[model samples]
Target: MKNADNSRRAFVRFLAGSPLFLAAGIDGKSLHRLITGSTRDQGEAFDLIDQVSQDRQISSPGEALDIFDFEPVAKAKIPPAHWGYLITGTDDDGTIKANRDGYAKWSLRPRRLVDWSHLDTSATLLGHKYDTPIVICPLGSQKAFHSEGELAVARAAKAKNHLQVLSTVATTSIEDVIAARGAPVWWQLYHTSDWNQTRAMIKRAEAAGAPAVVFTVDLIGGSNRETMFREAMNDTRTCTNCHSGGQPRPGVSGRVDDRDNRRKPAFANPAPGAPIPEAGPPTWDYVKRIRDTTSMKVFVKGILTPEDAELAIQHGASGIFVSNHGGRADNSLRATVECLPDIVKQARGRLVIELDGGVRRGTDIFKALALGANAVGIGRPYIWGLGSFGQEGVEAVMMILRKELEIVMKQCGTTSVRGISPAYLASR
Candidate 1:
């Protein structure tokens, strides 16, 4: 086993250095030659497991040419369990595929013979100016991917002058993530049954200079996650799922914000070692409760149906955030993009409409904006970058997205971010 591991690691280095590997990756000719050359390697499953383990331990971040580059590296480098948790949607993965493939359902209407001299991707959301409309979704358990975790993401977003939303379940404490940012960060509140606990979190966020509150309404309880179950992100002894009404064993706890140490945050969300609260659903009363507690602009996330979007706005929501919880919230396979147009029409410009899930490329962002999403939220792409290359890797991913969005915007003959509309879209 030892000999095989060392040989495989060496092969990984060779592949990484080879120019052919840059475009095709390790599964190309070199890999076949190595495996076929050894009789022991023949008829035996080579999972590339050792290579993955080595990459996670190495000092260097893997080579990254684009956002997609990070995915394979992350899967290879991180523990199978951790990577599985990050990438897995719900059962059947219909929503996951939808998020990625749904872009093909519509085509871009590129205007020609127009002035393509210069372009700007600058976007303003909820009165904040971002270099681009790309916002990182509030993904939790960051330390599971990289040592720097959410801090790495915060630094990257600050470096790019982009918006970053911190999950309530973030491994890095809210104050710590906020402290790491040069620009302001938004907070994603997992509204718990205990409104008092929820209020405490909101108050802490406001004091720490969080400009907005993304009240995620999708995950009231645990969604069915067979992938996570199989990957060891959960098990009998370590299942901290809210639906089970049990606490996971003590491990990988990110400190909740308590800057003054006067009052600690009472988190009621499902995370390692935290009790997943029995928060059933958000009501007008709950919305009012949130409003009564904080002055930060509140955007209700997890909205798919038009009636729900309209009701949220009517109940004093500042914006409608459409998300499928990255396809992790339910068994439904419908991607958030499919839900955007109805949401946009029902909200009818009553509030800012932001989207999360399946935002993998620059053209994906273009499609979202053209369909009426004011801003697009990215989840897994940044994590893949962070897991593979740390902070610099994340920064690289953002740069790629910005450059790609700029190129596509120019192709469509649109220069400004808000200038994007249905005019730039055609039926598939």
Candidate 2:
């Protein structure tokens, strides 16, 4: 076994060196000849390469130059409101741009000769193993996008052997989500002004078998998502779930319900009202409350500062998710990717660090891992996939990303995700 492994690695290294071997023009017999001539473990390597070559054809562009043109097509197909929510970052969206720009500052230094035949992109987090280092980031009210909503996403994640983080504002209930997927799910918690509600939600998530609690720290107050609001206004109907109990009534200062509901004509909007009862900002004490409530692993999202990262660890957070709320919270903040290295350094070994934002390619996944992210959360792309083709769309998106990651690993001369490190990147 050891010798076979070593030979596989050597053959992979040889493949990595020969650019001609990767060309589309190379016939299978010619490639077989090249491999057999180049390495002692030619037979085994040839078989493995043949499998990869077949799979590679699925992603390879034949008559087209732009393989990634599907992204824009998918983007255009999404509803205007959903598209706005997915694409726009908070405030001025500076942080969103920063996320993409940060990737440009780093370059991958592909190794010429290294054994990468047994590459695995699988990752284990919070004691749970996943097929890939990618997880579906929690996005709220997916039901608005499709009928399957969170359930569809959960099914897709289950099929791909990936993790799904259930948002506090998910269209489906936690129990139903678990029932549909029958897999451990991560819960994204939004801190509410009502402590009792927060505690209740946490207890419910635990009872439902959610493996982790990801506390979203940035959206204490509602964001100025003008596009979503505008789209909502244009629509003739409102989502019953969004207007259900717990949400503040429109133009009211506190929660409203069916018993106290009053009908105000769309044309007769003249009542002056106090500010709505939005969720108050959460402090470290809230983190403590979360820690006390659940034995599940805790991860704090929306962390952009080393100071905040330290505070999160000190407050008993098991992990930190570097995010800028997908550029929806505060546009002035640095993109989550830009903040990852520092947070990873500050937390040291005290916490596991993961990140999300502006990730569009498998190379982006590789880049984040190389820059100290234990894993990455994909938000909009999956949604686009969901909106476009429902479960099949989601499956297609996952397949694309996984294939991309495999190809990237093959090209970079590293087979295992663990082998991806800062050494593979240039500090441009």
Candidate 3:
């Protein structure tokens, strides 16, 4: 099986680099996807489960796997609707497109003649040291994408010693993920209509040994994802695997609960007998509420502004997850990377700033750090890896970033993750 998969990858690579692919009018970038754009997934979608390929656990051939490799393979493997759900951003893909351009917004100043040997990418977040600043952001409904869902991702995180933030809507239970990986995982929370449930979740994370809580606050309403909706309507993959194996079918009434819950403000209406007459999205008071309820460090995940970052710090937050909810919440004009510098400037080292959205490469991670991000969060890349090769695929994705970051660090004379400063950046 290992030989076969490697052969397939090799064949695809050769085909794409061949004159035939280019003669077909495929650009150099699209050639790889065009060549690998066939059903290579060993698993089939059904009511029962996503079958694990015999090669699911096999390590890559030590050759780096990038999106060009992962994306096409995943596209061929996973169901179209699931793929669309994982990749699509809000209305017209404005934010997603903008995110890709964010890295180009700044230029790195490479310094030569420095002792660039033996680089370090390790970073410390909230007193926890990580092998890399690349964190796995909380993505929900893993079973929706693959049978392993959060479990596979956790396995990869464990192997890499990278930090992973689990979603509340994750198909794999929080306890199960921690049990599978035996690694300290952070939890991402959303205020449901039931504040009791919300509080219970926080308490659970603490009980489960979560060191921190990333309470996402950006998604107060839904945005347009016409692509996902269209794909769901057209997807041929059968049901029975939906809702982490509970729902009888996929796309019930075309409802995407994970996304729907995001846009709706948490605790939008007041609980009975509450002091507040009416309700809106949970405010800093809500931040205080969660902080008081748990012993764990608190971080706000959806911050895009200095004001919000300030409120999070003042409200006892240990850090800020500077994001645009991966541009899934609304068609915000600015990408999260574009928004990072201002937020970092405003934060003034008062908060541990992390960012997500458009972080597909190692250079992107380096830029975020150079512009004041303490860490970087990834959402789609890992999922693309997850669908392509299960746990090993995800591991390869991280390895790719780590390897690329090493190249950047070595080139830019940034010897340590801590050494990455604004001095390395020249705003474009």
Which residue window of length 10 is worst by lDDT in model 2? Answer: 259-268
Q: Is candidate 2 or candidate 3 better by TM-score?
A: 3
Residue by residue across 255-304, what tens digits does model 1's lDDT show?
Answer: 23222111223253323344435455666567766776789988898998
At residue 28, candidate 3 shows an lDDT of 44
Write out the backbone clash pairs for model 2.
Answer: 9-115, 89-327, 90-327, 90-328, 119-415
lDDT of 3: 0.75
Better of 2 and 3 by lDDT: 3
Backbone clash pairs for candidate 3 read 47-240, 220-263, 221-263
Highest TM-score among the candidates is held by which one? Answer: 3
Name the lDDT value of residue 338 in candidate 2. 73
Query: Of models 1 and 3, which has the larger TM-score?
Result: 3
